[model samples]
Structures are given as structure tokens and as C-alpha cells.
Target chain A: MATNTEITSRDSSAAERRGAGTAERRGNAGEPPIRPPVDIREDGEGITLCADMPGVSKDRLNLRVDGNTLVIEGTARLELAENEEALYADVRSSVYQRTFALSGELETGKIEATLKDGVLTVRIPKRLELRPRKIEVQAS
Target chain B: MFSIASSASDSLFDELWQLQQQVDELFGSWTSSSGGIRSLPRGSFPAVNIGHTPERVDVYLFAPGLDPKTLDISIQQNLLTVTGTREIPTEEQATYYRQERFSGEFRRVIALPEDIDPDRVHAKYRDGVVQIGVERREAARPRQIEIH
Candidate 1:
């Protein structure tokens, strides 16, 4: 199960709520914006973010980095047969939005992103100075 | 008459809520076969939405990043089972700070309120969601009679 901490932290912020509200208002009638579950990990190089964004294709997904925040938005496309009406619907079709706060150590300019099988993987490399380095000791 | 209808609807909602709780329990109590460790029961992943129309009942499973070939759907009596597995290629020498997406085999079984025609059941997976439609039995459908 995905941890709820990241979602809770972002959701409790007024700025994040405003961003979400703006996205919802731009969506189709009765459709609300959803925050896709995400997994963030740190490694020797930097951090990797994996987001589950099913039904969102390459063209429909958008990623932006502004200052210290990274914003992800995607629209899911679902097609239903003609003359079909939903009777019980737990899944609502809508846009996906999420934001992450990044530190200055990250090299935002070189961030790489890819989408496959509806999962989005983003690799944010660290600044050269932030990477751990080993110093050689002279033998006396 | 209005009171009777309202009460009937209330009962239906109650039944649905009970079923949801049962599903949560079933999925939560399972033991991991590989690790031999007990995993904490968490909220349902790949959440589902169930709806019914006069003609049939529709089930929508929200699962993304699933290969269509790996998905298995079976219906026996009033039970509907959906099974599938997801595999993510391991990154060489990459250590994770947090791992959340569910991987490995997963099976979910749901009980229907009425018997359905298996032959008429149709399922389609698109845009990361599986849509299953099961036709209600002839006897269960509403019927109209002519006055003599």
C-alpha cells in the first residue's frame, strides 16, 4: 500500500488545495480532480518518483518544475459504449494532480520523465556538489 | 408507500456497505507466500466501483499498469473473481527510500446479489480499468403482465 504521508502533507496545505481547486474547476462537469498515488525514493544519484496514473497517455500528461515545486497533471480518457449509463460507479473519470517540494540540491533542469503502462517515472538528478564523494588518503 | 420504498433502499445500501467491508477484510488477511511475513492490512488498492442497471450489473476495477494478457476473470455461480499480477523490473543497485505500489499476485472475489447468465457476461479492459457486465437472470428481471 502507498504511504499516505506525502498525500496528507500536500493536501493540508492551502496552496495545494487552491491548485487542486483550480484544476477541478477546469475539468468537465461532475468530474473532480484526483491525486494519483506516488512513491518517492532516494538513491546515491538523486531521487526517483513513481506515480500511478492509469488511463493517462503520453500526450495527456504534463510535468512542470517551478522553483522548488514540481507539479504533475494528467487527464485520463475513458470511453463508454453508446446508450450505456452507469448504475453504480465508484471510479470517477477525472484529471490527476500532485505537487512535490524539492530542495535546492536537485538539478531540476536535468530531470527525466517517462510513462509506461500508465505509470510515470521521474528521475531527478542531484547537483554535483550534493553527491557524496570519497577522498583518497595518502599512506605515510 | 413512500416509507416502504425508502426503507427498501436503505436496506440495499446497508447490504452494499456490508459487502465492501467483507471485501476489505478478505484482501487484508492474506499472508505473503514468498516472504512468509504478515503484511499490515491497508486500504483497498485498485479500487472498484459497482453499479447496476435494469438490464445488467456493471463492475469497474481501477487498475493501472496492468498487462491485459495477465488479467484473469472468472464467474461461477454468484461469485466473480479477478486475478492478476504486476511485475516491475528491478533497478540494479538501486535502494528505495519508500516503496508503495503493490506488486505480485492479487486475487479478488465478489459475490453478486442474484444469479447471472454466464454466457451473457462481457468484460473489457481499457484505459487502465476493467469493465465487466453481467446479465441478470430472466426470472430476476422485471416483468409486465397483461390484464385478463
Candidate 2:
């Protein structure tokens, strides 16, 4: 079993406020963005990250690694029927953005990601040189 | 290749962010207290959106990574209930650094508008969102009054 360490250093900055002014507003252009919650765990092989981003499809999601920083972004669009009005709303359509600073121990070239059921999982493998190895002892 | 910046401003920004989150939570709990509907606990899993048309009412629940087959939706009287469970991958031995993703079973109950046609309801789960539509009673729909 791979025992992983949890990492919580990543910070998600709030996205722009679209239709946050009033409750009566009904439009898709000005909805505020939401920062989805995330969880990260590290094992002997690499790190795994999971984020909850509902209403986002595969085509609308973007994942990139810049230098030592990893970025995840998703855009969600919500459109109501012409005659429909919001009676009560706790969820809104908006962009989701999160960034994490990567450490030197990780292998930047071997990163992998997947999106399913509105959840995004990212795997960051460790460099072979950094992995622990056992050496045999020689007798004189 | 990371460069170090001023640490003072970073800490200040973090403090401000925390304060803003607290304020948002306070208001969220306040506005959702109306009617008999109970406000969700802070950081509740799977937030929801509810809307209505002249023909029917629509409820959208944001739940990603949930199996559609495992979801249980029921409507009784004027109450709409949604129940489901999400199992975490536990085969890998991991130490907690930060675990924010919600798992396990959860149920959300919503009070429907009056005069809803319980028999005329439909639900669909797609792209991590669950949409439930309940038709309004024919008598409850607004009709244009003609001047005689």
C-alpha cells in the first residue's frame, strides 16, 4: 500500500463576481466565479489531486503546468429557459481556478490528469533520482 | 524554478481571504433560513440551485463523481428528497495533508411550491449535475384575465 501525505498549501483565489449584486437578476453573462474545493495526497510514487467542479464538461476544462506551478481552470455556463425564473438559487455558473507550486522532487514531464463526473484528478509523479533506493553492503 | 517574494503581503492576503470566507458563510446561512427550509451546514457537500417555470419547477444539484445508479431520489407531498453516497479511494495508504473533498452518504430535502403535480416529475443526471423537474398543477398556473 502506498502511504501518501496530504498537502494543503494551495490557495484558490475567488473569481470575479458576475450576477452577485441582486437575487432577482437572471442572466448568464454576469455570474460570479466559484473556487471549487480540492484535496491533495502524496505517496511514494507521486502526488494525487482531486477537485470538485460541477456543471463543467471536459471541453471547458483546462489544465497546465507553467514552470514549477500547476494550474487548473474550468468554465461553467448556465442558461435558463426564456419563461423560467429563479425561485431559490444556491448555486451559480462561474469559472473555477486553482494553482499549486510544485517542488523540485517531482517529475514535471510525467504529470497526468483526468475528468469524470465533474471531478478532476491530477497525478504528479516523482523523479526517479529523488526516489529512495537501498544499496547492498560489501564485506572486506 | 520558483522565486521568493515578499512574505508579508502574502500573509496579509491570506488573512483577508479567510475573513472574506467567514463573511460569505454568515450571509449564506442567513438568506437560506426563510420558510421551513433548513439552511445547509457550512461547507456542505453538493450545493444546489432551484428555479421554476410556469409549467414546472426545476431543481439542480451539483454533485460530481457520483454514480447515477447509486442515487436515490424521491418526492412525497411537497417535499423533494435526494440521497446518494460517494466512496473515496481507500486502497492507497495515505497520510492526511489536506482532505476537503466530501465523501460518504448525504441527503438533501427541499420544500416544493404548493400545488405541485407529484406524478408529473422527471429527473436527469448529466455532466455532474442532477436536474429534477416537477410539473405544476393545472389549476395553479396563472391565466390571463380578459376584460369584458
lDDT string, candidate 2, B1-148, tens digits: 1334557777888898777566445433323435244647545766877778898888888888898899999999889989999887653686556678888999889888888998999988766888899999999999999999
Which portions of model 2 show Cα errors greater than 4 Å?
A1-32, A135-140, B1-30, B33-35, B146-148
What TM value does model 2 have?
0.75
Q: What is the fraction of true interface contacts found in candidate 2? A: 0.67
- Counting clashing residue pairs in each candidate, in order, gives 1, 9
Docking class of 1: acceptable
Misplaced by over 4 Å in model 1 are A1-32, A82-85, A128-130, B1-42, B52-56, B89-92, B112-115, B135-148
lDDT of 1 by residue, A7-34 (tens): 1113334445434433442323345567
Ignoring the other chain, what TM-score does chain B have in each prediction? 0.66, 0.73
Question: Model 1, range B1-148, lDDT digits (tens) per residue?
Answer: 9999999999999998787666434333221221112221233556665556567877777787788789999998877888898776657677776577776788767665465777788888765777788998888878899899
DockQ (C-alpha) of model 2? 0.33
User: How far off is residue A9 in model 2, in Å?
Assistant: 23
TM-score of each: 0.64, 0.75
